[model samples]
Target: MDIEKYIRNIADFPKQGIQFKDITPLLANKDASAQCLENLLQLVGGQKIDKVVGIESRGFFFGTLLAQKLNAGFIPIRKPGKLPYTTLKESYQLEYGMDALEIHEDAIKKGDRVLLHDDVLATGGTASAACSLIEKLGGEIVQCNFLIELKGLNGIQKLKKHIVNSLLQY
Candidate 1:
């Protein structure tokens, strides 16, 4: 669907030298959003997914839809204190400093197969931390999916143990 065309690039966004791949344009276009979701689903190849673990805010967009399509529960992995429940946290190194992500302690059951989704795979810290949270809760990661991946950042290196797929890479 040439989804990249729908992604608007903002230079030096949120910080200097950072080029943000904005998805707002894509979300605004119904057909592009649908096609992107469909492509993300294809990455699963009809695998049995019990839960869709979405990383914080952006992931929730397509993550919820993917969960619906897969008939799986949507689990949100958010910043510290965002979840109103007993939670499990995992900390990771970011460019600036260390950060943590939290998920409800009971979100996943033992042996549950999970599909992790995020908007972008930058340095892999965020997604990797989310994976740790899922594993700690006894969930098996089925696949780590993304809408966009910055290949130059080498985020995939941290996620080498699992199947990683992305709709677009820059």
Candidate 2:
């Protein structure tokens, strides 16, 4: 699908020396978007995921579709105070600054196998923090999935203790 071409690169976006990988172009292409979703679903297929935990914002887009494909419940890990129920929160560092994420307290039951999904994995801080929250709530992290991964960032290294997969790498 030449997904790379569809990913727009914004130099020094949100900060200096940071090239942001934008997926808006890919989303505009119907065929590429469908293929990307299918590929993501297949990559994590047969993992026995009970819930798909999608991080805030972009993760929600792919996470919901992946959850539907796997026939598993979609769990959203949103920003703090965004959820309407009792929740658990985790604060972490990003390329810009410190940020927080939240997940419903009753989202995953004990022993539930969960797959965390996001559009891109930059530094592994958000994903790792989400994994910690999921475990604290009794959910087992089966895998973590992403559409694009920036190589040499060592984001995957931080998450090396778990199964992590990405459809594209840059």
Q: What is the lDDT of residue 108 in candidate 2?
A: 95
lDDT of 1 at 111: 100
How well is each residue in 79-153 modelled by candidate 2, as lDDT tens digits?
888999999988988867899989999999999999999998988889988998999999989999999888867
Clashing pairs in 2: none
* Model 1 lDDT tens row, 84-137: 999998999864468999999999999999999999998999999999999999
Best-matching candidate per TM-score: 1
Off by over 4 Å in 2: none
Model 2 residue 107 CA deviation (Å) reads 0.5
- What C-alpha lDDT values do all the predictions have? 0.94, 0.89
TM-score of each: 0.97, 0.96
